[model samples]
Target: MNALARRNPWLVVACGAFIVTLAMGVRQSFGLFMRPIGLDIGIGRDMFGLAIAFQNLLFGLVQPFIGALADKHGAGRITAVGALVYAAGLLTAASATSAFGLHLSFGVLIGLAMSATTFVTVLGAVGRVVPAEKRTLAFGLTTAGGSLGQFLVVPAAQGLLSELGWRSALIVMAGVVSLVFVLAAGIAGKPPEAEEEGPPQSLSAALAEASRHRGYWLLNAGFFVCGFHIAFIATHFPAYLTDKGLDAKVGAMSLALVGLFNIFGSYLFGAWGDRWRKNYLLSGIYTARALLIVVFVSLPLGNVTALAFAAGIGFLWLGTVPLTSGLVTGMFGVRYLSMLYGIVFLSHQVGSFFGAWAAGYAYDLTGNYDFAWGASIALGLLAGLVHLPIRDEGLVARPAA
Candidate 1:
């Protein structure tokens, strides 16, 4: 390990984890607010869904540029700015009463903020300081931090909604979220000297090399499916369960279970990734998800079954982060890991847009989420096929012309 990491390895993980916990963990509960916000504003769930869909789209759209900025300028300033914007967006959401206003704040503003504060920044930091051999393990722990946040924050958000109402709760949450600025201070500056891999690659050359790799695009395709799966469940599952006559708390708890179980799942998968073929692991994950969804949908609807489904799915949740980032670094070198991972993450977010919107649209048209569930199962199978043939090897650099 580099001296910085060796001296305070836990600090690195803690900073990154705490950043994600706030960014991703807090966002997990956004779904819980969908019903209340929609009802208060006289909009349907589909309208709220559209706002969030746009948010996903925006998050993906800006990722590469933001990743480039992080690569060039360091993640410290970028992440802190993102948290401020995120806090502002939340405050905007708290005050907004119209659909367009909601989309502007909830959709565009938060989306931009998320591009900076989430995985690309956090993972890049940990991946930089940690030894090459230990990267995935570090990633798993940091990613689990996000999961842990979800496990704790979702229930707390529900309670806040009950006590303070949605608007007031958002204001309080925004205040708490500002702490990301402080946490982000830890990841500032470039990689440690001992961890540096000679000099950085030119952006254009790196982009050209990655663009030529078939494996890169395959990874993108597989990741797109992951985005779809997460968005569908995270944004809509709460509403789905409640619509079935289960209590609203059941929905919150289900999401919490996903977060809870994923903590272990992420760590275990991270450790396994150091030893196993990442592609095979990804294939298994997708296949398992498909099988679980089929069983969950087939079973009678109840909290126990729902929690079981959540736990099963959650264990697989975000486990993909360490694996996917590891693949990028393994194939392309860490010089531009943030940019490359961000592009792949953009693909994931693209799927997110469609997944979240499709669920709401299906509900609006059919009065149930059957169509969305079926689509999710199909996508899972397709993602498994996509990952099966990825050639996990370094791309040889062609002579520069």
Candidate 2:
């Protein structure tokens, strides 16, 4: 550790927290623009959905490479570049007049930009700085920060849209994202030197090694379900609420509630992972999501019910983050956390693409969100079952003391 790292680990955490907050807040705000942007551009919801789907797809495809770069070099450079691209993408999105422009700005640019700056980069940096004993909790804290962004930014963006139009909101948000560049600078400090045992494996070898681990494959499969549930709800819930004759603000607040409650839930679950079987905890979270979605879909749609559902389901939202990342660190060690976690996140983004696009397509075909909701419930249950058999022990052999 350097003098700054040795003296002030909390400072590093704060820096990481700020970066996560900015990155997630901006990303989450994208949903607020969906309906308005579609109407203004004279495009259908599926067009906007496809654009966001491409964003998620590209985001996932590039994340592993970005992670490798971060692990090899440092997070600061990648984060800086991501912030710049993200800002430019948002600015371009604000001026978009056609479907192609929307796809270029929102899909390609924002998606590729987010690959560098989101949870993979921030969590990898946190995993590097925090001690082994407190790693899970540290992961929780950073994940909570991202959730906090979701909580704060979504409603704020909605309010902005209510006051100014969506285009103006995007312009303002672009300026705010530029601040991430400053936070990225704080992550320039060096990571702790790897212990002298054997040299760290090349990125390709490390990836190949993880590929052979059964637990890693299980983790990826389970995360796919998470992506499906989150993307479907986040992208389409507002329109769903409107379809039910509820106020649009209710939909926005539902998203905000998920973000708010998830802050505590993520921290609690993260701490639980450190003390219990992480795979079991993940299984429980998924099961809970299944039950919650069942009840949410069956209940009569109203403000009270929506808010209650949001809060209840919110507790399970993003609770997967710490445990997922913790599982990777536990199995592989933190030496290559960035690369390993990025590959896992790729599974998540692929699922996100399906979840986001499918909801719009299904709704357009059926004129209701019922099919998407049903799929979410089924996938959640499947995720729970899939993770039940994962072995959560470390990969390397331990010497007898």
Candidate 3:
């Protein structure tokens, strides 16, 4: 598998993309379950939202360690184990009869599963295989896989909920997730001997170096905002639309549109990353998110505007993953890409915890999501500004002083 990766890197990218598609695709569908599960289980939106929030939090908390393990062992074994655990989480979620059960299944188990299966581990595999010049584009293409899953799976999930119900839908999803065990074969080996271009840095050395770098923390801060925006929108947008009196299908479609448009956005931004400065591109994406939210909230609620907003936001969505990961690779090299990027992703998930939970809390208190929307705008603008001072230069270029 390692030899095949060297000979044909695109294969590794394709397999990695599929793994993310299954993982994120199912994840993206969870929002659809919120209303139904809340009604059936006698829980409020706050409870459901908290569970999802915890999932994001644990997901981020464990990534650094998971990435380290993947770095030391290999992505294949980690991903395979994650696939089984993800299936178990889904099956367990189906059996959940209370908020505690939901938290145990969806929050703890699935969170850990995501750390193993999603972008951090997958992109690390792709980074080692693809040539440096094409890495950003490859990452973009790979990131697009999650969007593609959103595009394809959210609607399917909605249909399953309507037809077979949430429990059965999750069961079906578990069956789908198990396929990753097979795809794992593609990304199935340790980093090749030639993959690392320099004398090796110890994992502790990598962590210490990142801690001292001002720009690295800045990246973490910016990504935190990104997490907030995505989690708030993905988890609550459907419910928000329903609050506006639109049908539930509109909410599902809106999310699907987000996935659909993001496919192009991910590719374009990735291609752009290879040519232009990544930090500047990141700033633009975040700033655009702020503007989009402002316009979305200011306008009167309607189906057309709702779907349009989904398309607009979706295009800007997930573009951050590639550019941010690219910056880490450029600064530190791919030898520890999984671990460093995992640390950055942990910050993103921390923000996700707030975005998911706070919106629900606000909604429960105020009967509307206005506060969450306002906060998202503020954070987006801050993120846009924060990226400006980041130096995108490689590690060797930094002064010892």
What do the candidate models score in CA lDDT, each in turn? 0.88, 0.85, 0.93
lDDT of 1 by residue, 158-234 (tens): 99999999999999889878999998888776554344454446789789988998989999999999999999999
Clashing pairs in 2: none
Q: How close is candidate 3 to the true structure, as a TM-score?
A: 0.98
For candidate 1, what is the TM-score? 0.96
Over 347-387, each residue of candidate 2 has an lDDT whose tens digit, in order, gives 99999999999899988898888888888888999999989
Cα-lDDT of candidate 1: 0.88
Backbone clashes counted, model 2: 0
Best by TM-score: 3
Please tell me which predicted candidate would have the highest lDDT against the true structure: 3
RMSD of each: 2.7, 1.8, 2.1
Tell me the lDDT of candidate 3. 0.93
